[model samples]
Target: MSLPLISRAPGSGRRTRRLPLGALFASPYALFLLVVFAVPLGYTVWMSFHRFYFTAPGAEVDAPWVGLSNYRDVFTDPVVQRSFFNIAVFLVINVPLTVLLSLVLASALNSKLPLRSFFRAAYYLPYITASVALVAVWSYLFGTDGLVNHALGGLAPDPSWLVNSSLAMPVVAVFVTWKNLGFFVMLYLAALQSVPGELYESAAVDGAGRVRTFLTVTVPGVRPATTLVTVYAIITGSNLFSEPYLLTGGGGPDHASASPVLVLYQKGIEQAHPDFAAALGVVLVLFVVALSLVARRFTEKKEG
Candidate 1:
């Protein structure tokens, strides 16, 4: 019976009988992307090209399409303009400083220091905790009559944090840096560990000091990683949302910290204008993409 079964030719379906479990698992995600991500993304672009403010609570804003009107209005809206400007300022201040700090910490951790793992873990704890919790802690520290002012004993805090417009954006940046610092540290640490020990040893033998070897050898070896981390920061930073949302209480202190995502949230939930909110989303996506591309080019030039 076995011989007879072996003599029979396998059918076309049976010829490839084993199922591709990987594809089966992956297809749902692929389909989910098309359905959830691609479809919504395309719809948002369509919505962004039109005027979509409230005509009434229930009535449509425009019966006819108004191409690029929403985008024009988005740029012109005082709040929207301020948000873009604020994010630009935040990125300018934080990105470079984050890179520099991460590198320095990574270099220090790479050395023959005592309690190396303990220090590394301590530095990385901020990254492990939820940002929402971190923002809450920061809130108390910056409160009008909170610990910071109390610690000053007699000197005034001048203007209250969490309420002062001038201090709002920078306070937001500090929270961002604290939460983000560990991620970049981990990135740089990984890159540092990958550098060939031989390279440093040889450089040292040739009279290169620690600082000199680091600048010429360690830094160069991790250039690609440095580029990747910077670009990642730019992308993530451009999408500033939860940090400002929690830290500034939805752009409190007269909306000084109202980031694009907060703006989008107001449009959708507060304003009940999904179409307009969708437009805000489209613009945010474009900004991140463009900024990432620019960063990539800059990183490439440095490598070249």
Candidate 2:
């Protein structure tokens, strides 16, 4: 008295499918992304299009609506324009310095040297160090009466390194490149390690000198790392804030070193104009995206 093969259990005509284990595991992160990133990004974009403001009496809830005016003001504002220019200058100075110096350091570290481990640790120390702490040290060193000025031996007659309008951006660029160098070096080191020794051997067999081998083999082999480093440099350089904020107190002398993020903070937090800040943020996002695309275009290897 066994059931036939076509027999079915009661209420078993339809069955629901279970989610894949991988999706189940990933749902938490997906939810977190939705709550933390997606929501905020959407709100910022929405706020950018309105004349949103806090109520006067209670400073609660938003006020009237205006379209595109905030964006218009951001574009026309001289201070915002200057901030963008300052960031451009920083990128031009910082990106190449970061890439070249990190590559050189990685190449040197890749070779046998005394105290190589110690040097590696020492170089990477700045990157893991807190920006506030690093800025504090830099501030002490770059002050008018600081070690740098003292070391100059009256050559520049008590130069103001961090406070000078012309020099502030460059000084920030130098510190930023120094702070970020170790990370990039580590990246290049890892990339260099993956490059086979056979390639170098082949190059040497072809009568290539060390420099020529590096130029032909090493550089070409690490093109992916170069592209990564370029994108990182652009993003970090554009969003720069911590060093300038700590070293020069938000904006450098006459806003010479103010970045978009710094200006956004001033508008949103200090001035209580979140709408304008949102517009500034959107503009900054666009700027970074455009720059990243341009960088990728140049860095990506072209196929013949």
Q: Candidate 2 lDDT, tens digit per residue, 119-222?
A: 99999999999999999999999898888888886674334888888888888989988998998888788778878899999998999998899899989877
Runs off by more than 4 Å, candidate 2: 1-28, 56-62, 112-114, 157-159, 289-304
lDDT score at residue 218, model 2, on the 0-100 scale: 88
Model 2 C-alpha lDDT versus the unseen true structure: 0.81
Candidate 1 lDDT tens digits, 1-304: 0111112335567556576886897998999999999998897787676555546677754535877667666677788777777776677667777778888998888778999989888998988898778888888887877788788867744677677787787778767877878777877787787778899889989999988998999889777566665566556655677777877778866778777778888766698776667777888888777866665565455434
Residue 135, model 2: lDDT of 91
**Best by the TM-score measure:** 2
Q: What local distance difference test score does each model get?
A: 0.74, 0.81
Poorest lDDT segment (10 consecutive residues) of candidate 2: 1-10
Using Cα atoms with residue i matched to residue i, what is each candidate's TM-score against the true structure? 0.78, 0.83
**Per-candidate alpha-carbon RMSD to the true structure:** 9.5, 10.4
